[model samples]
Target: MKHTIKATWMRGGTSKCWVFERSELDVPGFTTDEVLLRLFGSPDPRQIDGVGGGSSTTSKAVILGPSDEPGIDVEYTFAQVGIDQAVVDWGSNCGNCSAVIAPYALKRGWVEPEDGILTVRIRNTNTGQILIERMNLDGSEAEAFIPGVPFPGQAVDIGFLDPAGATTGALFPDGKELSTLSVEDEDPRTRSDITATLIDAGAPVVIIDAQTAGLGTADFRQWPTACTAEMPRLERIRRAGAVAMGLAKTEEDAQRAIPKLAIVAPAESGSDADIKVMMLSMGAPHPALAITGSVALTLGAHHPGTLIAQQLASAPDGELRLQTPAGLITTWQRQIDGQLAVGTSRTARELADATLSFDPAGERTENPAVILAQGTGLDEQQLEPDPPPHGRRTVFASVAAFAVLGLGATLVGGGLLNPPATTADGDYAGETLEVVIPLAEGGGTDTWARFVGQELVHDIPGEPGFAPINDAGGEGITGSNRFASSAADDGTELLVSTATTVVPWVLDRHVVKYSFEDLEPVLVNGTGGVIYARTAAGVKSTRDLIDRKKPLVFGGISATGLDLTTLVAFDLLEADITATFGFEGRGPVNLALQRGEVDIDYSTTSSYHSAVEPIAKEGSATVLMSFGQLDEHGEVVRDPNFPDAPTVVEVYKDLHGKEPSGPKLEAYKTLLGLTYTYQKGLWAPKDAPEEAVDLLRDSAHELSGDEEFNKKAAEVLGGYPIVADENLSQRVKDAYTVTDETKGYVTALLKDSYGIELD
Candidate 1:
């Protein structure tokens, strides 16, 4: 008679394992080990009777159960079953297997799923540590992908918090950074002392220098063949170090598994990894990295005076990239609220879900021939079988379950399903919107994009949410062109534009492939600018600027960008100013002024408040003039935002004794109108459907009026007003329209003054 048990075969990171729910198994406490041993066909060199893959990586198991611990959702125990012995070691946890527990729990309804990134807390019974898994979930689909995994699947980020003492209750289990172990030589009378670092981070690991280990190359692939002759010597060192670390009573008692051995050396030039590491699992070379080993290496890299720290070139910036036999794996480590948090990416895939039948009365089928045929490579046929009845549920069932749980179906069968009309008040009820920002993260444009995206989630109809993707490069040309060429016109994709994008387009830059005219404006963001001067240049007020002797060196970005207005202001005031162009952005230009690299610079209100305000208050810098805002009659007027500062027009009149009017002033007005009055805008393809455009316009209008949005916007946007509806379209037209005379004058000025020619 056969006893059937439910099981899930999965590939976690680079390793494969079988996952089982604890309650489903009928075996008792100590006897459970015997059943698993027989089920995996262990205790024989080539156990063909069961499902062991004949290698340590392929021979692993995880038992999952609902956790009774506070704040932990599930408890998972990782077992390392021996390939050639009836032994099950539950001494340590598998980081790769730990990544899958959360997803499995979510699928089994062990934890409730939330929109956006979902956090699942799990307790690893083996190491007695808690792990947090953060995953991006869009219904049943996940977003991230691990770089080194061979297969295609969603990658989950698992963070081990305060992992320094996960295993042995101390970072250095043996309470020493360096330890010397004496190993017997082949001559039987000779002995050599090897230096190793025995530390417990994600796992207990013994780290040794590759050169001292007599390993010819640091390349892990070569180590398997090159270190074959010295395997016994290395194992002896591991055993000795294990006893010293108190993991074993004697060298013979050490299973040669738990404190895995690692050979390290300096990374080769042109490699992405900071260092090269080769890990051995169960006396064999690991083709790729173990996630826990990566955590251990990360901790060691940060720790002072360890072998890994000595070999490393410098301290890593949050993430540590290590080279392995397979490829590079990056791990990030940081202290959050005094806890050491280590995070790494791992991809999990459900290979097969079925019932495995076993017999206690039947003959043991331990065929070495079958085990040899299986080899060491991943056997997809054996690991993945046809989905069982319980596993092959229909999409309708999932949708019904979501509805009952009060979570609408944002995605069904990987396709977006339109929500009901009442939910969205339109057709785009259950859609996921993406807002593309053409700047790097932490910049003003990215901040604006995030703010708008968050507000849109609240204002847009239905259960729609917006996510921002920063595709920053080519000084904003890359992301703008990407959106123009590839973004879908179904109202799902929107572009976050800044002066960096509009300036290139207006200047006819060769790299600017996108046309502002080809896009439709849905919203316009208006921000004011202030021209400031370094106090060391002897300019405190607008009057002092005209009396200055030395030519004020103005730091600017590009001649055709927003700096055009500042350049024209210099001409209008008849000020002795020399323009130095090619700064990345206003932030860099301000830094140049602060460092005394330049005498004068202009910054948008947002940057001026955050960065320049402190310098101004310290008497290092002085505000000279504000660009101000244009009135309805197209006259430069005092900006309501900066009521204390005089307008640039007022400053020019005060200095030159006349109202500013010329080709320079016209060009300045055109550039100012384009850059300052409507510095940032939300746009979509010109041919976007009228209904979608109206929906977006309405959403923006609602967002602008929202009190919560206004409060947040004041902090992020420097109190800029969000211009929407017809006013937004009119602003775009006014900014883009320029007279032939003004354009010719600006083009010539760019060439003669700044040595820049418009294409």
Candidate 2:
């Protein structure tokens, strides 16, 4: 049986979490931990089987419920779902994810906004910390800004109430605020002792001087790879500090999530920040300070005799300025209800709203070290907020996924293994749809395949299990040939085709052994892009191609890859251009063009928004023409998305006074048909069961028409259309039929113009 939960994926501060109302996840016969672990595709580094983004910050879950406690609006549980392990660590609180609470509550109508402002009390069930968030309901995206994030969002004010004793019921958990931690190396003879301040407020932390770890103030200025190589010492410090705070009985029993550690140093004179700080989470240098850890660091810096306070030459008038790796963070401290409180500002945004169904019985790789973090998962919470009888944290031995919710991530999510069903009507209850993507994981093609294939299977008969295998090499040809020659011929297997592989085959490259003509098309997608030129190159329009004093320089990944379409377009237009092959990808080519190394480039519709428009608007480049979509009669027409831009055919007509005809134009159209119109697709082996093939295609068709899937796949599709029409099969077959004349033309053009020999 499959269990589904409605979720809202939101980014709070630096961490992103899948938010769920408590009632939606409190179902019977299953624990929230089990549901999240499966939904997140844990025990897999990539988390390809689930929605997890295969990282710490992206693999978190926030469970919110109405709070019956007086003056508190909601109580929430933050689950640190594992990305590459089986454990969910809830030993402490996440201030980063907390930034998401008030906005989510307002969006869900859980809280009411008063006169364009929203104030709500959110209690972190993990640490009994009641946080108050004051959000400007009218805060426009342009009004908010923070460190690490390249863009702005709604700014929120989060204050921790009486945060001092939230963890161990004392500001300084070890009685003394200042202490020395002697971290020993493998050779006990060699020891590294560091001065530290152990505190319990804002999620319990160990604050230390940077110099104690052999780092000085100079390290704070433009520090590259900041402390990544200090893992050994940091781990020792984290474990040692855990014991000093009485959170653990010994270093070996220290928990992975709690008693955070931070290194502090004074910022350079005249710098905006008062002090600079670096944090280590799960023994790795944090890209930025943890929202909760920063609260503690702020409090410690304000306290009279703490290490952080000593580093600050002087206290700030109101806010504490912290210089972190990403940028500067501003924090404030105040008295709330006569109790000490610290707060910071963060901007949050909702990424997606969807229902995710997970299978509890799918697979569970047992790791004895995984300690349950919730109350119901194992009849008890192993790592609770409750301090032990010794007035310290309870020691627990375990390694868990430390997914950090960091910015600069475009969050864009494995399959079960089972036997193949022989017939189309056969239920795939125990079967797995193994998709072979001939590209490296985390690229554009891989992201698309995982998104479509992973979700489309849910609509298939019995909702077969999904497993995507990336056999990346040879720029996709290696994996393509492997799949073509060896993948199961049953319906259980499918091949993913993109321009990288399609172009090679069109040129009849000797490396391409897999014939799309032999495979059956299940589904296909069409994309549109446009050729652009750097205005800096002294070219204003297509007319400049014939009488240019200097030929325009173009950068590309490879002539045999997607670049073939553009190369043919250049040929069709008879453009005076010098082609430079072997950049890396379109992005690099775009960068090179920007840097004036190349004078022209192209961008697909999806990236056109981020990559092209900005430069064009800045008057650095010109959008000369779009590749355009192929119509019923194989005629190019303006893309609905880019209608303002003329088609290449129109450009040719406008430049030369008539529609040019010849081998070059024919070859251009042929390459366009293969590389753009039918750019990406899925195919099943011809020998696969007839019933299975029909059923799979039917599901793909249904999924293609699904309103929800289309909405969710918009970004991944790069504004392309999932071609599942009744005539799609005919269209794909026609496009795949590379005529000998067109093939010979493209082949010769490659060898003559670019000096390439067909393998």
Candidate 3:
């Protein structure tokens, strides 16, 4: 008789696999290997009858159980079940599917939501390290939407709780600045003792200059051809480096996985990604690696002992641009020299994000993705992780859990994980913008806005003038409105805000009465989105969701507006949608999106674009439609970032009899018209002095034009250029031309959907 084991099929990164709870596989005496092989359907090219996707990368399994560790919410064990081979590798970690731990914990009842966001502390079973996966909830509900998955998925915000040298023994694994390892390849021309940076953040990796391999980091597709020609050399270097990094116990072990190889080049090199690092799958390069890896490489490049540090092209103390397979990745780093020891490389990765203001007079900006799944429950605790040999015993979980357990688990134990808290706060302090945001520190918008402030301080016309004050609360409007109302018009105080700034106005949910009209636009920054799903189900594409024949629930930043618009489109398409509103921010909403309880969500394109583009390409999620101004200017300029999908207008015309129109139609048009018209601008009160406003705007504009700023912006925006200007009033007005009917309809629509009756 066939052994029928319960398994959950999940899609992580570009791969798919079956998951089994530890309890489900407790058939005593059968080694873990025996059960895993049975799960993968060994020696079968066609795992046709099984959940395995057949590809080596896809035939994987994960077993999650309850963790009794004082600070951890759950314990996760990942098993890479081999296809056609009888081995199951459990030595390294899968950072991609590693994201699923929190969602899974919620589904199994490992964590309980407190208020807005529930922090699920995950003790990585592989590394015995703690990782905090921020889970957001709508009354004990998980919401989050990540890219590269189908439909809207559960959002589980993953942050390394104490991430230091997760792979290698030290942050800068090698004691020397650059290590020279002999090339084992047949190619005599390749350099012997090649310069490489072996740093351990989340993984052990060897970063080399593409030029060292006699190749350029131009296009990723071209690398396959280059690899084919130099396969022997590439293979040798990868293997040798793995041993040097201690990721491999034997020569053959490195050939399989761990200590992945990455090639970095100058951003001006016109490469596919300014820093093109191969993903987890060794045979086929990943479209892009995980964000954790990026952080790891960045840390390695700055240290003296790594190869990346030796080849360091001197960069100013500002934005550091990393070219990768996907595009340019921008990280705003502030270095603390004394902290650059072998195991302690302290730095901050500065990032930016934006919010939008809408009116019926203009086109609607693109609608970002939001969380759909709302996973429930937590598993019963069972697994325990052994601490790594050298590092401090760190547990990465929630503060509340630690407090309740009466244990002392440092956020970054012994300052080994991230930079010290004191240093982290002042990384960009003392010389900057005048505007201050009154929000919690380390928030997405807060981080980006502060980075922009740093840029202005570093390069703008009025250098050392602009300052950002943190006074964030009440959906980021109170602090922002404070800037709009009181800050000097000379552009000292600029409020960085989002669609919440406007959506609430239409809904009258915000106590502060204001609209896009109250603030003068300075320059639009950037935007990103959330992808969502439920934790219980592993549906990779929109097609999978549609096939399931269930109403895929979605959540919104607010009740109506952009999030609702996407659901309405689904409604028109006869796709099931159940949307909830009034969750703290996109951050929490994203956590819910991943739980499978809520199946869809909308987030900024910038945030989720990198993670999601591959999903669209892989046929997992439906592009549905983007909400942005119809590409005009006499020629249709495709979004180079998402080539397969059409513009919002194109999709609308294709889906319905006509394009999106009416008063709300005008609102949609107007919103899209200003899609990139600086959705979230650094603004002051309309009444602020023209000189102050001009000063701030001009400074911001000048900073935006800085070479470093431009390079980083290009990187973050996925190569699509951002237009940052000082005189946004004209730009805003030019994009704004609405009839009274359009205005009334927009207001009415907001009220009907959000329960707010705005005049």
Quote the positional error of residue 552 for candidate 1 in Å. Answer: 1.3
**Highest TM-score against the true fold, candidate:** 2
Give the alpha-carbon lDDT of every model. 0.72, 0.75, 0.51
**Candidate 3 residue lDDT tens string, 685-733:** 6776665456556656666556777787664444433445644677655
Least accurate stretch of 10 residues (summed lDDT) in model 1? 385-394
- Residue-pair clashes per prediction, in order, are 0, 16, 139
lDDT of 2 by residue, 264-370 (tens): 88778999889988876654456567778888888787777888888888976669989877678898988766866689899888889999886644633333223
Candidate 3, residue 614: lDDT = 54
C-alpha TM-score for every candidate: 0.48, 0.52, 0.40
Q: Cα RMSDs of all predictions?
A: 22.0, 14.6, 27.2
Best by lDDT: 2
TM-score of 3: 0.40
Ranked by TM-score from best down, the candidates are: 2, 1, 3
